[model samples]
Target: MIDKVAWLHLHQGQVLSTRSRGKDRYYLPGGKREPGETDAQTLVREIEEELTVALDPASLAYAGTFEAPAHGHPAGVRVRMTCYWAPRYTGTVQPAAEIAEVAWLTYRHRPQVSAVDQSIFDWLHDQHLLAE
Candidate 1:
């Protein structure tokens, strides 16, 4: 199993997503936590690295957690994604590091993301936080 953290940045009913270099699917802008890092710490670092933005730790709140079959992995390999929402941040958002593209995605884009991300889309849509 793999563990990962993600940031849920919503704007105008769309969620920010990123596509890594050489990858086909788009994903939320955060990554896995390093050893000894809390979820907020990991979120801030990963978001800065990937999106060139600093997520204010004080503005972080739990969104939800999801589990699904790991994309492009062997059967039974799973990934657990814990997500957070940040209401404030600094800097412009641009693709950085391994990110090749940044997109604002809605429920219609569900099939273009990974399994776990699809679940997030569902939740956001149900809550009317994501556009149809």
Candidate 2:
């Protein structure tokens, strides 16, 4: 299992997503966890590395966990995502290493996201947290 952490960053009520350099679909901003690192630690490090901003460890709120077959991986390969919502953050958002594009997508564009990201969109919509 690939344990990962992702952030649901709402900007002007819009959710931020990113497409990796070689990936075709957009995904929530995050990355795999390193050894000896907690979820929050992995989240902070990933967000900083990919978005060029430091995340407040205390501000991370556990959203939910999502499991899905790895998009481009062999059969039986799976990824476990620990999602988080951060209503408070410091610094500007910008694409960094390995990030191809950073976009703020709404509910209407949910189909364009990864399967796991679609689950997140549904959960956000159910919670009345999606922008549209």
Candidate 3:
């Protein structure tokens, strides 16, 4: 399994998502953990790199983890996504680094995300956390 961390920034019932350069699928904005890095460390760094925002590490909250067949990968490969919610952040969010675009996606846009992200959308929808 490919382990990764993701940030969930929900506002007005929409989640912040990003599309990497040359990627067709949008995803929750975060990335894999570097050596010796905690989830919070990885989350803060990833979000900063991908979304041009500074996530408050002290306020990071564990959301949930979703696993599914990896998008744009071999069939047998899978991704285990550990998600978190950052209640506070600084700076305006914009596409940065390898990110090609940024969007506020709702449950209706589920199909545009990766499989693991779709599962995250489903959970959010089931909890009524994601909607138009």
What TM-score does each of the candidates earn? 0.98, 0.93, 0.97
Query: What is the per-residue lDDT of model 1 for residues 1-132, given as tens digits with 9 covering 90 to 100?
Result: 788999999999999999999998988888888999999888999999999999889999998999999898899999999999998999999999999999999999999999999999999999999999
Q: What TM-score does candidate 3 get on C-alpha atoms?
A: 0.97
Q: Which stretches of candidate 1 lie over 4 Å from their true place?
A: none
Per-candidate clashes come to: 0, 0, 0
Candidate 2 lDDT tens digits, 1-132: 767799988766578999999898899999998899999999999999999998888888998999887677788888888998776778889999999899998899897888788888888888787878
Best by TM-score: 1
Better of 1 and 2 by lDDT: 1
Off by over 4 Å in 2: none
The whole-model lDDT of each prediction reads: 0.93, 0.87, 0.93
lDDT of 3 by residue, 1-132 (tens): 899999988999999999999999999999999999999999999998888889998899899999999999988999999999999999999998999999999998998999999999999999899995
Which residue pairs show collisions in model 1?
A: none
The total of clashing pairs for model 3 equals: 0
